[model samples]
Target: MATTALGEYLSARRAQVTPELIGLPTHGVRRVPGLRREEVAMAAGVSVDYYIRLEQGRERNPSAQVLDALSQVLRLDDDAHLHLFRLAGLLPVPVRPAAPEQVDPQLLRLLEMWPDNPAIVLGRAFDILAGNAPAYALFDGFQQGPNLMAKIFLDPDARSFYPDWDEVARYTVAGFRLQQGRSPDDPRIRQVIEELSQASPDFVALWDKHEARGTRMTSKRFHHPEVGELTLQINAFDVRSAPGQELVVYHAEPDTPSATALARLRATATVESPQADQDPGQPASSRSSWSGSPR
Candidate 1:
């Protein structure tokens, strides 16, 4: 998906709403299903030619007033409105080298001691900052390198690991889009976006949707090579005082086959520190032998 501006987003949204929804009269023999460009221009108090130019990417910049008008005319919600403003360059620029939040020592201790729990700590940009032994063993294949986003987007094994590959891909791209919107100026994020855009067309399509999401609760179904299939209840908790840092932990439902698999994995567990496994600067809680990189 191509990076879009406010004009393009507004125009696309307008084209999706029906005439009746917006109280517009459809004249006889209408060619387009939704409101026409002329109708949107009239509603937005702009010229049809200008609206066309905006939609075609000929005009990239838009003022706050115009964005407000367009937002009102398009009936966009607060999040959508903010997205439009950011894309238009009407909002204040995002801070550079975003301030890292402090991680709670308690949270850190929990992750360190949970030897059998497949838990991982992630940074705002989806960096696998840390994980316990089980997490390392479960996702070791994707952590061979330091980058998690790159592994999922570039590796083929990811499809086999995730039983619902399509849903996983969509969620991953959506997460990336949310990050891109929040930190548009981050050089690392830009490079990741460019790489994924080139690597996966599916990612490109989902990225274009401008979906915004943060690390939160989600259930995942994994087809582990060793464990077969495991359905887990995943909970993501923000580490208090740690801005942009989240702890994502996976738990198997009680008395189920997945629970049994979890128990078996625990029985075969081996403890390894992130520093011992990898190099300096990476957290040990996230290290695993599958890919052999420092957490």
Candidate 2:
């Protein structure tokens, strides 16, 4: 990626947004495309001079708090926000060599056994290494990466798939932050960050918040095209055989509507064999089995 000055980026983003976009009124024909320096300074709660110093590169060392404020005032997205912090030299994810993670052969069979539950093994980068029939059906038509982060941020269908998209996205970023912290040197983690940061504006904005909590087991809703709507509970477990892999299982109460919906799904969905790379709905995106999720 090309490097740009932090101040330069701040200035450029400032010029691209309009005052009206942020609830500020415009009185006459405006010469500039975006907010004025004074307006940005006021919104960010920094002195005009201080803000100017930042723009001129006179002040390079901005605290996290200050960057957050400026990022808001600039209307930057999650990816852009994180990029700003990196430009400011604030996000320090050091690179170190590490061993590649391997998913156990036995776990694949276990995932297949769970006909009622949606189960998958996620790699450190949240890649869906392997999933059961129900899990594949649950995510039908949406496989940006077959990786949670890519699916959430890169796929247009994600918003429809997730009812509480924003909330879930926040938790997703928080979970990624925690995992990245644990494996700063993992190349897969770095790859995920780089790919999403470049592709998704939302990911950029949410990432640098340093959200440190991994997603806990929680009940969430999904709008399944075949089944209408279903609420499923998430269960996350560390894969004992794989150092940075996680196993996520999803299920509903036996008698609940969700359970019934899953039953219907199982009937129509093909139980894909590992050899079924030619499965009609299985695209190249679903080819990799790196494990990750918001579970």
Candidate 3:
């Protein structure tokens, strides 16, 4: 029997919801990892057989109300709830080819203006489309390639570069899952996922969790070889001019040790000009590329 995306997603999510999480008493040794089909059906006001059919790909279409109830029982967040709807075909999934990512000239200028803040523009597949000097300096040695996912997971020094390696890995995988949901058919996204899955066991483990969420404004600790330990808050903004592009800026609070370290790093970092033959429109200090494509 062929398994549908909806079925696979439902099964994965169901396995994550514990019986105790929904006030169901755990009396004996349970064979399954999470709530049983019958328990889920009962909680969601559906028949056991119907729920089973949903998980087995026999049931194709379910009402919005039913999906909502199942989402509640599964304890899904906003992103996960939306992802479930998309998998169930209740929400439209935009199908488009991955186009070459180009950072807008105005955005590039904006990045050049912020000498103190480390800012980078990320493509749909988390490719480093563009980065100012400070941003490049911050990422420095760990940026083995253009893709942030590859740098975080495939790079040998990534674990040491990020003190919170485990947390960073989980967050990166979850963010990638969110991007995958948005562009399910994009070859670029698929290539990145396939490559990481083959290369990193840790990535495979985190990807299996099926957590779909975008990157939020959060503080991240980085152990820069030159600057020592630094904690910076990351802020990500969607590029309204171009879809599937995000501008991520890292900043340290004023009057903090991190701020002092960042200032020192910025002061020591020299901006690199674009090559003579490089695009004139491209920012002088910005490093831009779509080099994440599979070799």
- How close is every model to the real structure, measured as TM-score? 0.73, 0.62, 0.92
For candidate 3, which ten residues in a row score worst on lDDT? 286-295
The residue pairs in collision within model 1 are 1-204, 101-243, 130-286, 131-285, 131-286, 274-284
Q: What does candidate 1's lDDT look like per residue over 114-174, in tens digits?
A: 7757887776666676666777666655642655676666677777877787777777666
Model 2 regions lying over 4 Å from their true place? 1-100, 275-295
Best candidate (score: TM-score): 3
lDDT of 1 at 84: 74
Clashes of 2: 14
lDDT for each of the candidates? 0.67, 0.74, 0.80
Off by over 4 Å in 1: 1-4, 11-36, 39-81, 89-93, 98-107, 215-217, 239-242, 275-295
**Over the stretch 1-295, how does candidate 3's per-residue lDDT look in tens digits?**
6778788778888889999899998887899988888999999999999999998999999999999999999999998899888888888787765556667778877887888888888878887777777886777764457888898888888888789988888887788887888778988889898999999898888888888878563988888888899999989999998777788899999999999999988886556623223574864221344222210
User: How high is the lDDT of residue 261 in model 1?
Assistant: 86
TM-score of 1: 0.73
> Candidate 3: where is the Cα deviation over 4 Å?
215-217, 273-277, 282-295
